[model samples]
Target: MNMVEHPGFVLWFTGLSGAGKTTIAVALEAQLRERGMRLERLDGDTVRQGLTRDLGFSKEDRDKNIERVTFVAKLLSRNNVAVLASFISPYIAHRDGVRAETTHFIEVFVDAPLEICAQRDVKGMYKKAFAGEIKNFTGVSDPYEPPINPEIHIHTDQETVDESVQRIVTWLEERQYIPAKVTA
Candidate 1:
């Protein structure tokens, strides 16, 4: 298939829950939008409520959820719409499966320690997981395989949101995934 007029790619944000994937994704989406990029932000929780509503936390269901997201991302990218996907895609195989389908894939690992994430959890998922209320919870009951070699790694614990956004913008410019904006 022919490429879109403007380059479009998958900016995949993968990490543990409360690892700042959504925070970074939201800011990045805004910046990209300001730059006039046609894009979509497909967050895990939002997708779960809709497309993956029937899917549970089982590995099989998780895989199916990711597969659905990947399919949507592929469709958008093929039309030159960038995708900012934030998911706790803990399985390497699942992440790799999505990667294999995208033409321009940038895997970003939003790194944060489990303890820190737990401390910052507004949804109380970590608290519930620790209390045995939630099963198959990534980092609590499920496995979260970090990307072996992610294109970008955001240490969310150490960096402020602005700093992280700047880092990603720098990376995007360096890679020419997005056009560099001219300052007035």
Candidate 2:
């Protein structure tokens, strides 16, 4: 389907905090850059700090945040940029809304146990949530609904960063979104 000519698409990564969504997204972005692809990365934490600073963590606010991100990602894709997003978009309806807005939406579920994620709290988010410093936190005070049928399921516990990146890159190539290396 000549994805490159159609402005590429979005690779949406969803999961609980510390689930390695941002880690995988960053690795994939670096790999894609190495392959000379135009790309944009939108991580939920960073987005909230800037574009969605005023938004709270309420269900409505979360939905609105995802809606804004979906629009921005779709626009970037329409301009021939591969948009990669890492967010804990915790609702089926919100994810479906994003899918409806973009033609090439690849949902990558970063599936990791809450206990594992809590242990790997690189940013101290889990600690804050557990201490009641952060309210409405997914997998803690709030809920995290897993994807019913994600395009790819990345179990961070079982795979290394390189392996995860390779899996995603292979998916892009197999789906014809990117060119494959020619056999000698």
What lDDT does each candidate get? 0.90, 0.88
lDDT of 2 by residue, 111-175 (tens): 99999999989898899999999999899999999999999999999999899889998988888
lDDT of 1 by residue, 1-184 (tens): 2222358799999999999999999998888876777888999999999999999999999989999999999998877888999999999998899899986889999999999999998689998999999999999999999999999999999999999999989988898888766454
Candidate 1, after superposition: displacement of residue 76 in Å?
A: 0.8
| Alpha-carbon shift of residue 60 in model 1 (angstroms) | 0.7
Candidate 1 segments whose C-alpha is farther than 4 A from its true place:
1-5, 182-184
TM-score on alpha carbons, each prediction: 0.95, 0.92
Candidate 2, lDDT over the whole model: 0.88
- Find the candidate with the highest TM-score and give its number: 1
Looking at model 1, residue 161 earns an lDDT score of 92
Evaluated at residue 164, the lDDT of candidate 1 is: 92
Question: In model 2, what lDDT does residue 81 have?
Answer: 84
The lDDT leader among the candidates is 1
